[model samples]
Target: MGDFVLSGNVTRRENKLIPHWKGPHRVVVTNNGWTYDVQEFVAPFAIITRHIMRLKIFRDKYLGVTEDLWEYATYANGGHMVQRFLDCKMKFDTHQWEVLVQWRGLDEAENSWEPARILLEDFPLLLARWVRTDAKAEGMRSFVLNETSSRRGK
Candidate 1:
């Protein structure tokens, strides 16, 4: 593969509630599509060869600069509370809902997915916003369906 970045694997050391996907380590070499050699700056100039499944293609916009990655990891690892809720979704298997939250003072890329109930209880304002946004989306969806049906009738 061309220049790419590797994503961090989930670890018990990290808070299980938070959705973590850290990294954008630069790839130094590639052994066809099966494996790649990457450099980890934080690991102190260490090079590692990993299978293709363990790596993700690097996107400059989403990953941002290498410096920012370190800052994000520090903030996230520090157990800082989430700043605000961005979105929410229900889990298909567990039927439990989760919210996408952005931590205070951190970049959007540092946002994590958290359990909706915990967020609602901890940050009540998030519940209000979620209700308002959901209502608006439902209204828009109904409007679209009505318009489509009217056009079909005509």
Candidate 2:
């Protein structure tokens, strides 16, 4: 039941030219062979469930690398799509602004700081959204920070 398997059309497809199967997901529930529940995450939870007929046993080609990433979330030239901008900072030497980019399908810890100039050029809309975020204008006492270790999601 722990073996990975390739999946069929679990999600709706916009383009018909994509690959037929996109996963080698770990089987979470066998469902007695009628239906199987598969999880693509390293975390312990099932994200997809499909009938047995739409699945095929998968064999790993590379050792220790098995996560089936977002086959449909990349940009045209295989670039990572930014989910959002989480933080902002000024570069120490260049004095240029940088924003922390939260990539699609990745966790918060995987986020990275990118040049604001580049982002403003590549993704102006995203940079605009980040600029419009509440501004953390705590100087006006409307928003609070450093009050506690707990914080809400953006």
Candidate 3:
């Protein structure tokens, strides 16, 4: 029941510059009418947002062209595009690395913990950039970077 579609229902202040659509919500249900239940993807993989919108509403969205700074577009092969790697921490129970993934169009507080293994496999370049910036930004030890480099060699 998961498919992406924009929703034109989020409220906003009256402004001539505002975009009409609010989401690339995942479809959750097919109600009896012309409406559908959609949800925004939130962090922790547990929270839910409910917004049911009709198929049209002055047809909200961009001009069908993706901009570089815009958020949450999938890769050509269909997966979330990694906007940035914001932070990292070792999971105490799993004993593995989890990188904080900054999804486009979302706040830092909404970023989710993504497995380093998946990021390494999927978006190595973004992971590398984060490694360099994070180490410099916070004076983190290079042990993690070194570990990453070793993984990259394979």
lDDT of 3 by residue, 36-110 (tens): 666554332222444444333322232232321122322322555555666777788988778778775677787
Candidate 1 residue lDDT tens string, 41-136: 464557777777777765544234444454333344445645656666667898766667778668888998777556544544334434456653
lDDT over C-alpha atoms for residue 34 of model 3: 62
CA lDDT of each candidate?
A: 0.56, 0.57, 0.54
Candidate 3 ranges with C-alpha deviation above 4 Å: 1-77, 106-110, 136-148
lDDT of 1 at 96: 69
Off by over 4 Å in 2: 1-77, 136-154
**What is the per-residue lDDT of model 2 for residues 8-76, given as tens digits with 9 covering 90 to 100?**
764547854443564556688877758988876433334788888778887532223321132221131
* Candidate 1 residue 95 C-alpha distance from true site, Å: 44
lDDT preference between candidates 1 and 3, better one: 1
Number of backbone-clashing residue pairs for each candidate, in the order shown:
0, 0, 0
List candidate 1 segments past 4 Å from native: 1-4, 8-22, 60-66, 69-101, 104-154
Poorest lDDT segment (10 consecutive residues) of candidate 2: 140-149
What's the true lDDT of residue 119 in model 1? Answer: 53
Q: Pick the candidate with the highest lDDT.
A: 2
The RMSD of every model to the true structure, in order and in angstroms, is: 15.1, 12.7, 11.3
TM-scores, one per candidate? 0.36, 0.40, 0.42
